[model samples]
Target: MLADGGSRGLLRKTFGELGLLSLSAFLFAFSFPSFISVDGLWPLVFIALIPIVPVIHRCSWAAAPFYGAFYGFLSYAVFNYWLTTFHPLAIFIVPVIYAVYFLILFPALKAVDLFFPRYAYWIQAVVWVGYEYLRTQGFLGYPYGNLGYALYKVLPLIQISELTGVWGVSFLIALIGFFLGHALLFTFEYDASFFVSLKVWFSRRKAALAVCSVLLVGTLIFGFVVMRGSYDDQRPWKVALIQHNADTWKGGLPTYRRNLRTMIALSDRALAADEPEAVIWSETAFVPGVDWHSRYRTDSERYALVEELRNYLADKSVPFILGNDDGQKADPGLPPVLSDGRLNRVDYNAVLLYENGKLRQTYRKTHLVPFTEHFPYKKLFPGFYQLLVDHNYHFWEKGTEYTVFETDNGVHFSTPICFEDVFGYLSRRFVRNGADVIVNLTNDSWSGSVAAQMQHMGMAVFRAVELRRSVIRSSNSGMTCTINPDGRLTGMLEPFAEDYYIGSVPIYAERNTLYYHWGDWFPLVMLSLGLVLLLVGGVRKIVLRKS
Candidate 1:
């Protein structure tokens, strides 16, 4: 007992819980997009959470939640450093929310570890995935830092997203970290080297190792096979995506006119090619409401600009698609705000499609970026809400529909405006409802960070795989590209450059993927199974104590 105490003391002295927590936080920070670079040290993610496990395993139950909270806040504070550019207060809000998340999460994890000692690691991994799923739901759904995204460049491994909606990949990686964490914990307890401890640990855990290996190998083989699976129902498709290189933040008729001219110039260049079916512009590319100005004509300058754009589209042979505000009569609800005078029109972040010089279809963005685009707690947090408004943050009315658009040429697609593509379920819903392709129109220029742009672009890879539909991201100021059904990126335009990419996109009329059919089932199942196991563990503990 005295020797055991000495060993444990030495372990704590050599690497304290705070030290391990800081190590994990730094690893977690660098594992995603940070100031380091766009394509971060992604390889570190495989073992990123390994150090945290010992901190989790050894900490007193009272200390577990605080340690977890600190880890969460520190990790995200570093990873989401770019959020400071989004808004000064954003950095605090995001990390504090994560801190609160882990405050609750770690205690539950510690409980499971205490009760289900043998299967704790596996169950904890499942819980981690469940946490991710829960976090990315409803108004606060932010999908950055998801473990699966680190594997965006590893095409073969991430093909599992088509099966499990990125949650499966999270589970696999988390499980690997748990196994490695256990080995590290052994070394710490025994004062032995990691390699010797890992070898000893591996011999005792052959069954778990085999299962994990089989899963890893199986997914790789599946990926290779899926990559080879040709889309037999594909058709010849061509679309032009324009990057006007204009700052989306700039306003007034002067900035709008300059942007419009830049786009028209870029469009002319694209139109010079074999007649493309459609030309796409980034989200909110045209700041003025085309619909409102064309009819209201209340502001002659804005109205004339809208007419100029309409005339340009009318003269073109191809369908014109661009993001603009769609103003409709307001029947607004939560986060109440004033409508435009007696016009009473509430504007939505919307995409408009022009066919034969007439407006053919419109897809209003359903998923709004949480505080920046749509805030719901106006009455409850009026002062804070006004502060957001004071910070030059404007809000839009949320459009409540999964709108699929069809062109005059018989092609069908959905424009998931901006970060809507980050949510797999939204893309799945679009595919299930007959969107042949996913064209994400985005204005990432406001962030003014290429690392931020790359991080945003990376998530689109999974959306393509999950639905087996092609994803074409058209962004203002960066990352205009098409991701094929197999999660391959091609025909990319230079970021922040005045350029355009005309891709001969292959329209895959392939059947929807498993992820589309059963959307987010893996995470749901893991959450449900976790609750059941925890309940069972509680009952067993009670029975054992009584006996």
Candidate 2:
């Protein structure tokens, strides 16, 4: 009877702890993009992980990984719910892969607690940032939900990204979560006078508090100073962003023609009103590939379609940057054929610039999306590659160079197609290559989710702030807008709306951001520090065991 009672008690306690962990996961999800419309609720991110911290601290090392994985799976499943819109399988696969990150993180935190007991909170925070840095690396490095993105609307707080990238902001947020969690743990668990417990916790963690305060204050001061600095030499380039709310998937050729006509009519109206320097179109704005402009020049029907577009551009007398599939004849030296057994040609998702009916520049999309766009490690697994091919899944070959285009007026810009703009380093490379502005051409009609579009825009805003460059994003279905150097949205078009916006984007010639010069160095340093600590901890444990 006594043994049964003890087992039941232990089971009840375990369930209670799991409940707290679940609450933390829920709060963490709610603090991110989709769940909360109000950006002011971002402060909830600081305390969201507090509940899980206690669970992690109290659980045995063997159990910590499971708890962390469960927490991560639940949190990510909720935060990235839009992934299901792409495929139902994503709900299972993505969370399972993402949970491995937390599984590793929790054990590292336990090691920190065991090795550096006095500064466990600080070490835990470092480990958190280190894990986040790791998440942004390797074959499947996705830089989503980095906590800093929650503060996108808080312009002043995010200017620090210029110096430290998103990792620094994530480090600050993790530090606050650690501090709050530690304080809460002391308040609840300490079996002393409440005030005494408070004083003891404060004394023990004063160094962490001091460091966090300095970083927070310094970041804000730096932000304000940068914001106050005048852009007296800044030149405004008026741009017309066209969003033709087209259902590219279900839409046949007739629908495509109608959408194209609508976009052309809208562009004409916008040009008549403002006469912008250049007009931009979303990804794959038309059906015909750039190759058809020359490849099918002999075919009257195909040639006429290409001629119609060229004539329109010539009539407008304005330069245009638009998306198209540009193709090149495959090298005969290459061995393996495509799934269709045709290796005659290779196609690229490219952005082409046209001035007075002549193609001036073509920038192919690099950093293709994994699996769906370009399968990683396919050479090693030929069977899996064949399987994908059997399913009729066609992937675009990755582009090699960072291509930047210059307008006749001497304005320089780079077009990063689709979610390529989400990568800070890729955008930084363009800025380094003398791109004054980023023109992103994307087609977001597939997901058909407003939250997904807004979430993507939220991340893209950071790219503008990180490099102190303007970003003009034109999407097929939504989020067509101009973002200034300060991350402010201007002339934003409504989601799923057939609309066009004309706005002036400030061109900053100076590209001296620390992030641009030294990409992601802060996170790399943190990751290195974490590795050193783990090595030291492992050495100490081995020495003690031998002794």
| TM-scores, one per candidate | 0.94, 0.92
Residue pairs of candidate 1 with colliding backbone atoms: none
Cα distance off (Å), candidate 1, residue 467: 0.9
Model 2 root-mean-square deviation: 2.9
Worst 10 residues of 2 by lDDT: 292-301
lDDT tens digits, residue span 1-547, model 1: 9999999996775468879888888887787766786777888888998997777788887888888799889888888888887888899999998999889888878878788777777988988888888999988999998998878878999998988988998899888887788777878876568778778878888998899899899999999998998754579578899999887557678999999999998899888865788899999899889988776676789889999999988877688889998876565442223444455568899999988899888888898988888899999999989989998887988888898899878888999999999999899888888889999999888777787888888899999888888899999887899889888987788888998888866788656678887899999999898888888888999999999
RMSD of each: 3.4, 2.9
Estimate the TM-score for candidate 1: 0.94
Prediction-by-prediction clash tally: 0, 0
Query: What's the true lDDT of residue 11 in model 1?
Result: 73
Candidate 2 on 93-171: residue-level lDDT in tens?
6788878888888888878877876677777778888888788776677777787887777778889998888888888
Question: Which regions of candidate 1 are displaced past 4 Å?
Answer: 1-15, 191-193, 231-233, 331-343
What does the lDDT read for residue 434 in candidate 2?
Answer: 89
